[model samples]
Target: MEIMNNDAVRNVVNDVSDQLRRALFQAREVNAANYIHVVLDPNHPVAPFDSLHPDHLEQRVPSVKFHRSMRADFQHQPELCPLVVTLYSPGDRGYRDEELLLETVDNAVSRCASVNGSYVCGWIATTLNGEEFARHIAVSSILSHPLSGRKVLPWFEPHRLALIVDRYPSFAWSRLTNISSWWFVDMLQQLRVVSPPEVGRNNIIDARSTLLPLSGRQVSAVWDDQRRIREAKLVAMAMRKAGLSLPEFPEVTLDKVVRQAYENGLYGQQDVVFFAMNCLTLSEDWFLHPVVQAALEALAGTDELTLTDILAGHSDAVLHEIASYESAGSAPK
Candidate 1:
């Protein structure tokens, strides 16, 4: 997969819209129905469902219909519920009404952007009815964990789809695929397709019964992925707070800074974020200074001061002196 620049990230909505149009056309050619699976974020400023007519929402399988069996608490909330919007080809029953609804949905999806907190995560092309399609999504949403019993994995989240597809085992992918294909916008803001394995194409077994328990390795990997995501968000927040743009602090540089923070025994979210914020404001190698090194040692020792407190205790002149030394020494001679 190619790494997308900031401009390409901004074009993700258009890319997803184009993919949905192509998927609809392909589904029609194969006599299949298209179902859009969207997990609504209650905190998002814009509510996509609010723009749709009541009748259009009525056409969708009610969130309760599929999530009634799931144990997740969020499933009970109407705003946080996952919606499966069904779209049928022309001449199909209720096709005219669906066409109008599809236009509204398409517009909403086209406006989706991670920067704005996108709610539309993925779409499915399958022969299953709306309820059956939703059932698949519900079962796939929560996975069986060997030790925890059950865990909710938001694999459908656009930013998480690539991680799930690349890191998760084959069994997980088998359960995620629908009759036709699953379409999602990956973390890179690029559209991706996952098709059902040829051997399982004819299998009609219930997914709930076949849900595989995550292995110990899978559990560790999942946790690590979650941590990295949190760390990335923290880094982004710190950059914004420092008034630094992505170009000024590219992903590659940000990743190195995060790794260095971890290497320096800064595991706590606040400490890691503080470390990252300073690295951006100062130089990435500023910690090599004796003042910064002493602070890190104090944090590692029995000192009562937290890393944030110790760092903030330093005078602006002292911190700038450290940054100036590091920058001058690291400069190309």
Candidate 2:
């Protein structure tokens, strides 16, 4: 509940790793507070799947891995693999770079908001916006259990992702900007829930084996998935119920949200808002306008006025505050 301080975020990630070990031991639970697993294909032309994480860490907990391609499309991508999540939680001694790391996260979030060219921006925003993540954060794998036969990896830091943007331009950014926000959110949401969608039923193919074999385009297909469509509908409903203006783009979509980050660069895009907003609406994860969220957070427990009232008006300072935060790990706080 405290502001997502570095220590707390680190603790949560640590807990997730631990939960992963415990779950694998008794096959009981795989919460986010513990550990997460990343499955790699033995035949894939990426990092070695056998020795990704250090041995000392594994000795600390019981972990499992199901070696095979997932039916999903991200199976073979190495960059998305574990990519070294902070091994120890903030509670542990390993969180030495808590401040710096948090700054990194801050930068990532801000950049995502500043740049509309990526779906991750909305996803990160939604993750920071708890209640939406509370129950699901504990899931061991991004979409399922670590050993769920699907390859799993750590989420990428924004700056880290941005650095590589120039490298895989046609590949990564194209996926982020060109795709629908709902699609990423839907897939992200689905990954946390139960088993992935069935690639083929009756004929009985293991989701574990085929999930990753999916081509980049196939994985990206989640952008137009039925689940994604459903998420879009829900977002539209929330906005309508809130009496907020809905985007005129495709009915109830994430293009609006991604566009907000893209065009206006709510985090600081200079003026890409109008263009991006033209393409999308809301992401599956509803990161209400930061101002809206701030008003609600600042009000804390007054219970007197509604959120609509709080965010209805703001001075220029609010804009500056937002700018500072978007640039660094939150204004000089």
Candidate 3:
């Protein structure tokens, strides 16, 4: 996975923080008591808490709690434990503390980037009180597997959390916790939000004893989601290598191109990437052209030619004509 550079990370974090601040103001106006908490993975080299000033650390209002203390196995490994710090409260008089906490989170995320991605997962805003919210998140972190018994689920990690929300049924996830909204920066360096399904809001589980089981099918779905995420990252990297500026919300385009590649039986990494590059370079619907479709069909019937070989064989005039057609069709009449 490509790690975002410092500037890119800072811009994304600022955008996310702005949105979170707006959420806080909106909650205050409605007289709803909400708390914003930043969750830090201690496993990261520069944890969010480490970025905080000594005075900020000593503050009692934005209290810090270890999620691992709620579980036995994680208790001894404090260094590996995840920390949740309350950043904002409805009762706060000013935004100074919240701003400081956001800055610390920004610095933490910028410094924690590895080849895999940033370890600073993100923040959460909820109506539940601080202690209740912490307990609920702790309970949700443990998953029961039939074969392995009980294990910790790093569902707080942005990518893993995204996969869970994308694949698991709303009722299954919503019943496990009482989070109003979750905000996280995705692998694409884009801010994303996950909220409880409206229908499942009132059905939250209240006790730690009611742990959700990790089914085989759900596990498989998560794996599939991970594969798709990897493919999107690959496509993004390819585009960048080619000096192509990414479109806004490029993940949406990347996902479509990757899915189209799979649908056309281009399963090999080279074939899939080649197909995606062409679609991204020309048009997402480029393969739908009659000439392109015929070329794909002919290529599919033969093992002699790869997608790259077949597509690259097209004359410059023919490729240009296809691109022109797409451009014309997309134009306002």
Task: Find the 10 residues in a row with the least total lDDT in model 1.
Answer: 62-71
Report the poorest 10 consecutive residues by lDDT, candidate 2: 182-191
Ranking by lDDT: 3, 1, 2
Q: Which candidate is the best by lDDT?
A: 3
Please, what is the whole-model Cα lDDT of each candidate in the order they appear? 0.56, 0.30, 0.61
> Model 2, residue 327: displacement in angstroms?
31
Which candidate order results from sorting by TM-score in descending order?
3, 1, 2
lDDT of 3 by residue, 1-333 (tens): 244577876777788667767765764554446667766665554534554533345564545532332543566776566656667667777553655557645753453223344446666666656577666666666666565666666667665666566557552455336555677765445567776655333423344445555567665545455566567667767776666766555545666688788888777777788788777777656777788777778877787777667657789988787775564356553
Clash number by candidate, in order: 0, 40, 0
Lowest-lDDT window of 10 residues in candidate 3?
108-117
TM-score attained by model 3: 0.64
> Which segments of model 3 are wrong by more than 4 Å?
1-15, 28-33, 42-81, 89-100, 104-115, 127-153, 159-176, 186-192, 197-219, 240-253, 267-270, 288-306, 321-333
